[model samples]
Target: MNAPGHVLVVGASAAGLSTAEALRRKGFGGRLTLIGAEPEPPYDRPPLSKQVLSGAWEPTRAQLRTKEVLDALDAEFLLGDPAAALDVERRSVSTASGTTVSADAVVVATGITARTLPGQSGLRGVHVVRTVADSLALRSALLKARRVVVVGDGVLGAETAATARLMGLEVCVVGPQPAPMTGQLGPFVAGHLAALHTGNGVGLRTGVLLDALLSQDGAVTGVRLSDGEEVAADVVVAAIGCSPCTDWLAGSGLDLDDGVVCDAHCRAAEGVWAVGDVARWHHQGLGRLLRLENRTNATEQALAVAGNILGEDRPYLPVPYFWSDQFDVRLQVFGVPSAENTVEVVEGDPAEGRFVVRYDGPRGPVGVLGWRMPKQARLHRAGLVDHYTQPLEPTAP
Candidate 1:
């Protein structure tokens, strides 16, 4: 396929900005346009839950690039105007402002929207930190809140709870998982996290479902658990999860399965490609469609998509790495970790608050996790590529 003369990138966050910048870096001199639903320029999201929420850094410090840096790319940016529809056949995107932009190729990087608790709408002190505005609002609410209930046990939820605790709020984390981050880090590693939270005076409640948000006088007062118990709270932050922002691509003739389904090369259609959290592309290693929701994957996939747009047929195969910072512990993982996998301590000791752990699948060691031991984890991560490709041993039925 010939290189496109003009490229349109939808959703100007980390993935979208990286895609446009990569096209320029890769010598694509054609016209480039980036469309964003948010009014602000691309900014770092990881810090939103940490430094920014903790009042250690200003929101402006989270920007990925300054106006001067963004302008140097020479791309037309359409901010705050979200794409309302897509005409894949005509290779055009229509914004909510009644503007239609055409391009030879389109890159979808709309990313994900945070999931909220049911009946949370119009309730005061109920927040989800997905954007700068969200973090700002939640941070403001945290200052006045004495008892904060954080829903979900994922990275975002855990991080938020940790931040709230550091800010001296009586924080309670409620989730359905047996332990925090159990799905990603497995039970053994997650046990340490549970201890970390509880040790810091953060209440950890697991294996329970959230029944409903209790509000009185248009303000959130507590959360009712499935066990018929109400946990009182002055503020509630729902870090449940996120879904891809692909509502605009409903009738675009592209496959949408939780996310914009794409091939191994991140190509959704003939001239349409998907990147970032909104993309569910075939993972060559996993032999299945996987949608990653991390900053690393977003940037890496954006670069790969840019290469594919330039006629490179490289498959987007990654080790699937992620990290989280809670309290004084920095947890990092490389490759996939499953609860069923056999976990072993590779270095250090878990009791010491620093260690390198390896998760062995049927084939071999498929993942390495570091708790305050990043250098060692990185060294072990090199072995995951080989183990990921090795055929797994069949389990007895």
Candidate 2:
């Protein structure tokens, strides 16, 4: 296929910016237009819950690229205007501002929005961290809050609780999981994380279902749990999860499930490719459609999509890596971590807060997790392919 004359990227964050930059690096001298819902330029999101929330870094410091670097890309940036519709047949995208932009190829990298709890809308002192503005607002609230209750036990939740505690706020984290980040790090490693949070003066309440958010005159007061217990909170931060930003493509005739469904090459249709958190592409190794929301996957997948857009028919096969920092621990993971997998200590000691653990599936070791042992994790990551290809053992019902 010939190189497209023009490419339209429907996001301005890491994935979109990476795709545009990769296209230029791949020698595609085409017209590139990057559109974003936020007025801000491309910025890093991983530090929002940590540095930004803790008042250690300003929001501008999270920029993915400087103005000089962005200008060097020579791409048109349409900021603050969100795409409302995609006319795939006409090869055009209509924004909320009622302007239609035509392109030879389109890269959907809209990413996702933070998921909110039920009855959370229009409530004061209730926050969900996703964008820079979200972090700024929550940071301001934390300064004035006395007690903060963070819902969910994912990476964002754990990070938020840590930040809140750092700001001297009495912090309590509530989640339905057995341990914080259990879904990603598994139970054994997550137990150590739970101890870490507790050691740092943060409360942890696990395996409890949140029934509703109790409010007093349009302001959040506390949360009611399924066990009929109420936890008083001056502020509530819901770090449950995020949903893909795919509502704009509702009737675009493209496959849309949890995200923009795509093939192994990240192609949704002819001239249409999806990347980043908004894309759920088929993983050749896992044999399933997987959507990764981490910063690494966003940039890595964008590069793959860019190459495919330039007529390189390569399948994207990644080792799947993500990391999180909370209190004094730095947790790094490679490959898929499943609860069904048997975990074994590979190196170091979990109690000492410097260790490496491997997740062994029915066939063999499928994942490697490191706590302050990134070097060891990288070493074990290369062996994931061999384990992934091994035949699975039969399981009892």
- Per TM-score, the best of the predicted structures is 1
lDDT of 2 by residue, 71-122 (tens): 9999999999999999988779999999899999999999999999999999
TM-scores, each model vs. reference: 0.97, 0.97
- Give the clashing residue pairs of candidate 2, or none: none
**Per-residue lDDT for 290-361 in model 1, tens only?**
899998998999999999999988988888888999999998889888889999999998878889999998
Model 1 residue 269 lDDT? Answer: 97
Alpha-carbon lDDT of model 2: 0.91
Query: Considering summed lDDT, which 10 consecutive residues are worst modelled in model 2?
Result: 386-395
Candidate 2 ranges with C-alpha deviation above 4 Å: 387-397
